[model samples]
Target: MNMAAVKLQTSVVSQAGKHTASVIFLHGSGDTGPGLRRWVYDVLGQNLAFENIRVIYPTAPARPYTPMRGAQSHVWFDRHKISQDCPEHLESIDSMCENLSAIVQEEIRAGIPKHRMLIGGFSMGGAMALHLVCRYHQDVAGIFALSSFLNKDSVVYQAVEDASQCPPLPELLQCHGTADELVFHRWGEETNSLLKKAGLNTSFHSIPDLNHQLCRQELELLRSWILKKLSL
Candidate 1:
């Protein structure tokens, strides 16, 4: 968990001209950057076509996750089970946040303001995304978490509080299914409540009759949300 931050590989599709904005979407534990790019590309094409926006899907570092039975997977963090919590969770999250910070810095150095970039992810990736926004030194255009959990710490809470003092902490959108068998619903509630307590702008959507996977409704909402954020 203390490994130096490695530059994450990304599958990028961008406009040939100057990019008005950029988005980096992190995939779930077992998913690859290229795979997520296809999903995100199709979703955006269905509703959003801002030709100046650059969309990227970044690969996670390979780790032999215990839940995967020592099988290496591109995961943002290590956890034995979706809902299981442990002391090492903090370390895992910090490492991932550092890695994400590196990605955000790259965008900033490319003449894109951090506030003009969006970062988000699904499942474990979602958890990492949320954590990165909260823990990092700066904010972005926005962030969304799908089926993710919040970190447990006064330190993280303090960071969110401090970030909010700067005004306009990256907008937070948390969506989770009520019947999500893996991460469960309560964690989503906890995340929402935590952000609210820190005075950060955060919203939570509890999808009814949904499971571990994204449904059409969630997809539509995600598309709309991203479009709205980008337009800002």
Candidate 2:
């Protein structure tokens, strides 16, 4: 059990209604826990029926993104060169999966059922969400990946296959910006293809004219999907 107790900043919003589920948001690279307050308050908070669901935003530790970047930012794992078949990148995925598993476990201990939980993130955080949902053994309600890519090499494929044999796959919804320059649009296409090939139920959406960033339209779409999944 090589685990580290990482401190995470969290907030909860409860309304005068039956709570049906909880969503844990993992922020993208360079964003802090408090910085995501707007997303929680404006986007998800306003759109979702707060009476039935709650949201948690966790901040990652600040770590050097690269040996040369010098500047450190909040990230689940070290940011490395983007490659479809990079071994080092795959290793980073493993490390992040471990961290995400611990976070999810903590949430479960706090009374959130495994099937009532939704894990998601944006950009690099999106990558982590995809990795954890595929590797984690429990059944999650759904996974929301925004402006992200999957590490779809042979090693990752094997991991997904093995996990599927033992545990049920969770529903997956992926949203990508067609005009994203930071992570090429092709990455999203490839991720969808890989998941579909593996026989997982997945939905993919391409936001038109969007760059490597989130927009109102995309946020609304995510909100609708999450609510529908939770039946709230």
Candidate 3:
């Protein structure tokens, strides 16, 4: 069933979670979440390997993304024309994060606590995951961001910094390829630092010779992490 609460259509993959955990994985620019789901299932040959968890893949809606010459495409948010310079578009992110938060709420309403779920993504989608989980005032199980980075100077980061008595941030497992020509490796490191600064428990892994993609090692690490999280 497609989740209509979000601006994009969502595809779900049901897994057995110990009392039912959940994961929401967003897709990158110009890609659908279902496509990512296929790669995850067919290419990776995995099922999330948990007892009873639902994996959610959400597709990005068509929008006037500014990065690719402002052409219409699927993207979490509009990448500034200057490309990672400054003046983060908080309004757009705010709307999207609201939708993302709603998705989590749907999961919670379905009988999962904030501690029994994790939100993750790759590339731009990863950026969205990190941004929403950290910036928006929401509680979730954890976060796993791959080849992703945070917009340090954005309102989202400001929100993280401004909240003096904020609720505890979720644990994070973030990884990036050293040779990532697309998102740049340093952003990943920067995001990790920011999360730590906010007192969030985050683990950062740098994949050597890795590019703007995932490796088998990365998948294995993710699998191990998920299993550990599920306590299986």
Q: Give me the candidate number with maximum TM-score.
A: 3
Give the worst 10-residue stretch by lDDT in candidate 3.
Answer: 1-10
Query: How many clashes (backbone atoms < 3 Å, residues ≥3 apart in a chain or on different chains) does model 1 have?
Result: 0
Which ten-residue region of model 1 has the weakest summed lDDT?
80-89
Which of candidates 2 and 3 is the stronger one according to TM-score? 3
lDDT of each candidate versus the true structure: 0.75, 0.72, 0.76
lDDT of 3 by residue, 1-232 (tens): 1223465579988765345788888887788887888767764777444567778898877777777787888777776753456767666777788778888878879988878888889888887887787776347767889888766675546555554366566778998999998567987888788767866778999999999877778878987887677553
TM-score of each: 0.85, 0.85, 0.88
Clashes of each: 0, 0, 7
Q: Candidates 1 and 2: which is better by lDDT?
A: 1
RMSD of each: 2.7, 3.0, 3.3
- Candidate 2 to truth, TM: 0.85
lDDT of 2 at 101: 75
- Segments in model 1 whose C-alpha atoms lie over 4 Å from true places: 41-49, 151-155
Better of 1 and 3 by TM-score: 3
Candidate of highest lDDT: 3
